[model samples]
Target chain A: MRDEFRADLHIVSQLLVDMAEAVRAAMRQATRALLTADRKAAETVIAQDAEVDSIYRQVEERVCDLLARQAPVASDLRAVITALHVAADLERMGDLADHVAKTALRRHPSPAVPAELRKVFTEMAGVADRMAEKIGTVLSKPDADRAAELDRDDDAMDDLHRSLFAVLLSDDWPYGVETAIDATLLGRFYERFADHAVNAGQRVVYLITGEPTA
Target chain B: MRDEFRADLHIVSQLLVDMAEAVRAAMRQATRALLTADRKAAETVIAQDAEVDSIYRQVEERVCDLLARQAPVASDLRAVITALHVAADLERMGDLADHVAKTALRRHPSPAVPAELRKVFTEMAGVADRMAEKIGTVLSKPDADRAAELDRDDDAMDDLHRSLFAVLLSDDWPYGVETAIDATLLGRFYERFADHAVNAGQRVVYLITGEPTA
Candidate 1:
């Protein structure tokens, strides 16, 4: 029974890695579409969301199955429960990517934003992408310290987000309200993506410490 | 052992009820702040989030303890896991309320959103609040039919969100980018809140039906 449970735990970890990677890829596509205004890439991200959603469902079912079949205890139970939350977080992150991509599709052509502002948005996407990668590492390795380090990326993203808006509010912006809304939504999607990644890292810390940290 | 497990299950149900009520109250506070731009109400919602987070922690710990100690099987295992996921969702919904209240505080003097727009937002919040309540009932009762009905509310919220945005965009309002961002973010928060509540209800359905549905 113990060996079987351990094997099931290993399977759960692998599934989490898969879910995280799938979401990271979707985010990458979404961000690329946003930066380049690539309609095809945006459409691809939207199209592939169903794949991520299905994987999420499978992971949830597997975790429940493991609990029913193997009856995990203590830390094992925490791991299974954490897996469920982690999958949900990743799935929502996927939805955020879809949001960005759909918004990009709508805003494509006619140059909605200035080059400098576009650079900042792209950089913010990079921050979110790196955070997503760090989340994958945290899930696979359960490294609380590494998770904490990656967790602070949200603060930096927040600073960039504010700067991005300050520029928009300044007299330099000429593209008008439509462009501003697109930029604002893009900033928010990246910010929220980073936030969920932070939440994932925080969960790792909770799992390691057996206490929920801020 | 079976009877002891059932007792543990009962405790889990009670915890779900408690957490759900806490989140409902928080949503009410957030709505009051939005409607009235009441700083006091916003502060109350922000302050209450800590309690919501703490209750989330307590529920997680207690559920994990039960899983570890009692070693629930089959449906019992599903119930505990569902409770864990649902509690996390409720906690997140509380966080949304905090976000809404914080946004409300910043927008105080309530800068000129039309009555129609306000009405849609109010309806969205109400749907979210009701959906959260319904999920709690489903958790305590394990009623699949009621869980199914929650999805209808989600559809309603989405419709309102669409109409709200159309009104915002079609208007020739001169308030500029700030108001647009505020309106969009408010709409997104309520939309996502309803989404999470839908997820919670879906989880309840999965627990009872042993099948995944849209």
Candidate 2:
């Protein structure tokens, strides 16, 4: 029974890594769809979110079962419980990507971003992709030091999000209210996506160190 | 030992209820500050969030300690674990309220809502307060049926959020980009505040029914 429980725990960790990879693909496609106005790509990203949700449920069920059957104590208990929250964070990150996809679908054939802000958003998307990659690495390895870097890397995304506001609030701002709202909402989605990645990474740090990130 | 665990569990519940109430008060002050552009009110809301965080940590520590010592199983286990997640949801709700207060602080002396949208936001704030109230009641009692009502009540807030989009997207939108962005983000913060409430309440339902809320 004990060995079986430990094996289940290992399976849960692997499932999260797989889930993270799937979300990364969705994030890439969703950003592409948003930048290029590809409805098909957007639709694909939206549909793929179902897979992430499925994995999330599986992880949740496994955690609950482990808690009930094995009754893991101390660090083992923390690891299982932390896995649940990390899965939730991953699922939410997938939803954020879905939000980006829906934005693309809403403005289909007309890129959701203004031409002037295109470069900035492209950078934001790049940062998001890098962060997702880092998340996958941490999930697979559970390295606290590497996980710690996700936040430092995320500062770029946050700065870009604020820069988006500077553009919108500037005296020379020329975009209509619609474009401004689109940019604001999109910027928020990407920034939050990175934040969730940072959050997930921080959870891994907690799991490894047996200490709260704060 | 089991009886002591039950007593500790009861205390956790009470702490969560009191935490919910404090968060509700913060929500009230933050919304008032946002609509009125009252700097002092916003500042107070901002400052009070620390107490909510402090209470959150206390709840978490108690729950973790209970898990470690009691080794609760089945429904007993579910209650304590659900309490952990619910407390987290509550903490996030408080942070959302703090976000609202900060937005108010950022736009000090200039009302966050446009003149025409004032009535709608007033209604949104009322809906949020009502949801928070229901959450408090349910936290104290832990009734699945009562907790189920939270999602239905949340529909009003969702509708209001949609109404915000309608205003922003309307061809007649007269506000500048900055105001449109502000209203869009503010609308989202309130909508999510209600969402966290529903999430917390749903966890209560799970606790009662011993069933996943999916």
Interface RMSD of each: 1.6, 1.5
TM-scores, each model vs. reference: 0.92, 0.95
What are the per-model DockQ values?
Answer: 0.62, 0.66
Clashing pairs in 1: none
Which parts of model 1 are misplaced by more than 4 Å? Answer: A109-116, A209-211, B109-116
lDDT tens readout by residue for model 1, B109-179: 67324465778887888898888889778877889999999889999999998887776677575566677
Clashes of each: 0, 0
How big is the positional error of residue A185 in model 1, measured in Å on the Cα after superposition?
Answer: 2.3
Task: For model 2, name the residue pairs that clash.
Answer: none
Question: For candidate 2, lDDT tens digit of each residue in B134-167?
Answer: 8899888878888898888799898988888888
Question: Candidate 1 on A60-135: residue-level lDDT in tens?
Answer: 8788788778777777888788888888889889988999889878878644456869878877888888898999
